[model samples]
Target: MAVLEATNPAFEQFVRDTVLNMPAARHLGFEFGRIAPGDVEIIQPYREELTQHDGFVQGGVLGSLADFAAGCAAGTLLPPGWVNMTIDYTVKILAPAKGEKLVARGRVVKAGPVMTVAAADVYSADGAEETLCATAFVTMRNIRAARS
Candidate 1:
């Protein structure tokens, strides 16, 4: 498997394209905040459809946000013809999810031929303030895309 070139981009356009392409999450309406090389930021609103009885953000939603951002971060570095897959991940929730929106910051710590590692943090976004809610580390597999 040759090193992937132009794998994916870690920017607003890349994120928009990918999210729009996804089926289930298409309605989530994620907003990419900081879309630069090797870095990605996003904001996801708190919606009743994505919450539990306690009215908190679902773990799955949080995980998806982390995964999406991490992938974008890794994509910025991956060569073309290659796509990234989440091989492993860990998350730690620090506080309850509250506020109108959740902010996520995901960035690539390391990008290699076989693997790409990324870290992300979720925060509660309020007026001129933010609070940490969760954090995650994701390791992704880098491989060539198959053509049928």
Candidate 2:
């Protein structure tokens, strides 16, 4: 991903604060590791409660992590008072999610006033090894603050 700066100077703080306020993120124990313009990373520790009967991390948890990372990357390009929400999302689960933790890195491919496209790669990290577990492509629409 090309390094870019957000048009809104306070975007970094906004993104961080937004993530802190997201109930899904909080419930999933997602940690925002990096938040750069057009790029973001979210990490979550593996927990038995988040696993399925097969002992693999549930797909829903992975999907939520990817969506949050992708949406934040897209939001970095939006103006202040404007937010981006995912309109379309597609994910491909590549491998079993068996690891000590999960990390997702998302990057914005295209950012426009109306829509943005981003992709996230989810990895399963076990000790010192990290394996690709899933990939997601997300499209988001910008939402401006409503006029009173």
Candidate 3:
């Protein structure tokens, strides 16, 4: 993927602050890995609470991580006073998510004034080994941020 320039100059810092403070991301144990324009990475360590009965990570958790990463990637292109929200997200689980940690990497595929398309790949990382666990596609809609 070609490196895309960021429309928002403070996008990396913005993502760091916004994602770290998000309640759902925090509760789900998501930690920001890399935050750059049109690219984002999130990591979550395996925890019992985030697993299914078979000792694998829950699908919902992977979906949430993908959605979050994709949304953040799209946000980098938004103009000031604008925010993006996920309009559609689909995830395909390719493997059993058994690992010490899961890493989700997302990049914006296309960006426009009102809409953006992003894709993410989730991997299960156990020590030096990594496996593709899921792939996701997300569509985001840009809207004016509501004033508090």
Candidate 4:
């Protein structure tokens, strides 16, 4: 995989301040694994509350992880003071997310002035093994942040 570096020197901090600080992300305990231009990785530690009756991580949780990772990846490519919002996303759960943690790797497919397309692959990590659990494609609308 080609690694893309962010033009913004503070992009990592920007992601932490905007993405990781969101209420839902904070509540779900999502953390940054990696953040770069057009790429990102988010980690969600396994929690009992996030699991379904069968003890596997819920589909909704997986979808949320994929969405956040992809959106953040798109955000990394935005110009300074710009942000991206998820307009649409589709997630497919392929396996039971039974593991110690979940890692979502997201990469931008294409970026434009007003829109960006991204994709994410979610994996369930158990010790040294990782299983592909879900995948997602996301579309984001790029917009300038409104001054407060």
Q: How do the residues 1-148 of candidate 4 rate in per-residue lDDT, one tens digit apiece?
A: 6566676678878877898668899899989898888889999999999998878999999999999999999888877898889999999999999899999999999888899999999999999899999999999999989998
Higher-ranked by lDDT: 2 or 3: 3
Quote the lDDT for 109 in model 2. Answer: 88
lDDT of 3 by residue, 75-118 (tens): 88777678888899999999989899999999999998989999
| Predicted structure 4: lDDT | 0.91
Q: Give the C-alpha miss distance for residue 97 in model 3, angstroms.
A: 0.4
For model 4, the stretches where C-alpha displacement exceeds 4 angstroms are 1-5
lDDT of candidate 1 over 87-112, digit per residue (tens): 99898888888779999888888788
For candidate 2, write residues 35-134 as lDDT tens digits: 8999999888989999998889999878887888899999888898898888999999999898889999998989999999999999999888999999
Query: What is the TM-score of candidate 3?
Result: 0.95
TM-score (C-alpha, index-matched) for candidate 1:
0.85
List clash counts for every candidate, in order: 8, 0, 0, 0
**TM of each candidate vs. truth:** 0.85, 0.93, 0.95, 0.95
Candidates' lDDT values, in order? Answer: 0.78, 0.88, 0.89, 0.91
Alpha carbon lDDT of residue 31, candidate 2?
A: 85
